[model samples]
Target: MTFDLRPWQLADFPAYQALITAPAIATAIGIDAKSTVSQQQAFENDLYQTYQAAILIDGVPQGSIVAYQRANELGEPLVNEADIAYFLSPAFWGHGIMTDVITAFIAQLPPHFTLWADVLADNIGSLRVLEKVGFTNHGTYIDLFGRQIIQFHLYR
Candidate 1:
C-alpha cells in the first residue's frame, strides 16, 4: 500500500471526526467519545493550529500525525522541543503503517529539534511503534486525567 502525509484540509473534517470519535481512538487521545458536534468542531479547530498532517493510504486519509511545541508544567512552550502524537483507524492497526508514517515524519524534521511522546501505559502498540522508530523511554507518570502514561523521547 502506498502511503503519504500532507497538511489537513477542510475536506478532511468528516474523516477526522470519525477517526477521533471511535471509542478506542478517542480514549487513547483523551477525547471524549460522547462529545457534541460543536465540541468536536472546536477540537478540530485547535488541531488545525498545530503542525499536523493527514496520513493517506493510496490517496485516502486513514489517520493523522502531529507535532506541537512541548509545554512546561507552568504551560510555557519549550524551545527546540515538540511533543508528537498520532492515531490510525482501527482497521489499519498492526500493519506497520504507523511505524512507517512516524519514521518518515521524523526524517523531515529539523535536526536541532527534540521530539517527545506520551503514551498511555496500557497502549502497547504505540509504545512499540515509538521504540521501533528510535524513541527512548524516559519512564512513566500519572497524567492530569489520572491515566498512567509512559514518556518517550528522541533527540535529533
Candidate 2:
C-alpha cells in the first residue's frame, strides 16, 4: 500500500494519538505510551513550528512527521537547524512508509536547512530508515529515558 504526507489537520489528532501510544510503536518511537491527544497537541504547539504533517494511507491518518528547532527554549542560540520526529502505527512497520514520507518532506524544505533526528540506539528499524534516506550519524548520547540516543543529520 502507498501513502502520502499532508499538512496536519485538527481532525487527525485522535488518530495521531492512537498511533503514538501503541505499545510496540511507542517503545520504538521513544514516546510515552500514555500520552493523550491533548498532550500531543501541546507538544505539537511547542515543537512543530517549522513543519508538521500527517502520514495518510488511503485518506486515513496513520501517523505523523514533524520537524522544528532542536532547542525551542528562550536562551538557546537561534540556529538554522531542525530536528525531525515521527511515529507510525505498528500495523505499518517495515513497510518503508516513513522512508518514503520523510524523503519527500526533506526535498521540500527551505534552502540551507540542516535536518536532524534522534532514534533510540536500539531501534534498528528507525536507524535503518534514517540511513536509507541519506542521514549520517553524528554521534550517540544518553537520553532521559536512560536509553542511548543515536543522532542523525542531513545537510541540504
Candidate 3:
C-alpha cells in the first residue's frame, strides 16, 4: 500500500477524530472515551500548534504523528528535545503502517534533537513499534490517570 505524510488540513478532522476516539486508541492515549465535542474541538486546536502530520493511505488520512517540545515543570521548553505521539485507525492496526510512518517522519526531523515517546505499559503494539524504530527504553512513570507509562527515546 502506498502512503504519504503531510500537514493536517481542516478537512482531515473527521478522520482524525475517528482514529483518536477508537476505544483502544483512546484508552491507550488517555483520552476520555466519551469525550465531548468541545473537548475534541480543543484537542484539534492544540494540534494546529504542534509539528503534526496526517498519514494518508490512498489519499485518505488514516493516522497521525506529532512531535511537541518537551516542557519542564515550570513550562519551559527543553532545548533539542521533543515528545512524539501517534495513532492509527484500528482498522489499519497490525500492518506495520505506523512503523513505516514513524521511520519516515523521523528522517525528516533535525538530527540533533532527541525524540521521546511514552507508551502505556499495556500497549504492546506501540512499544514494539518504538523498538522497531530504534527507540530505547529510557524509563517508566505513572501518568495523571495512574497508568503505567514506559518512556522510550531515540537520538536522531
Which candidate wins on lDDT? 1
lDDT ranking, best first: 1, 3, 2
Taken over the whole model, the C-alpha lDDT of each candidate is: 0.85, 0.80, 0.84
Q: Give the per-residue lDDT of model 2 (tens digit) for 1-156.
A: 799888876666667667767787677665666656544864466344657778889999887788876556765844768888887777888888889999888887888888999998888999999999999999999987788999999998
- Candidate 3 or 1, higher TM-score: 3
lDDT of 1: 0.85
> Sorted by TM-score, highest first, which candidate order results?
3, 1, 2
| 1-156 per-residue lDDT for model 3 (tens digits) | 668999988766777777777888788777776767744773575467467888899898888888888889999998878889988888888899899999999988877989999999988999999999999999999999999999999997
Give the Å shift of residue 80 in candidate 1: 1.7
Residue runs of model 2 more than 4 Å from their true location after superposition: 35-38, 41-43, 46-48, 72-77
Candidate 1 wrong stretches, greater than 4 Å: 37-47
TM-score per candidate, chains pooled: 0.90, 0.86, 0.90
Model 1 pairs in collision: none
lDDT of 3 at 15: 74
The C-alpha local distance difference test score for the whole of candidate 3 amounts to 0.84
Window of ten residues with lowest summed lDDT in model 1? 38-47
Error of 1 at 41 (Å): 5.1
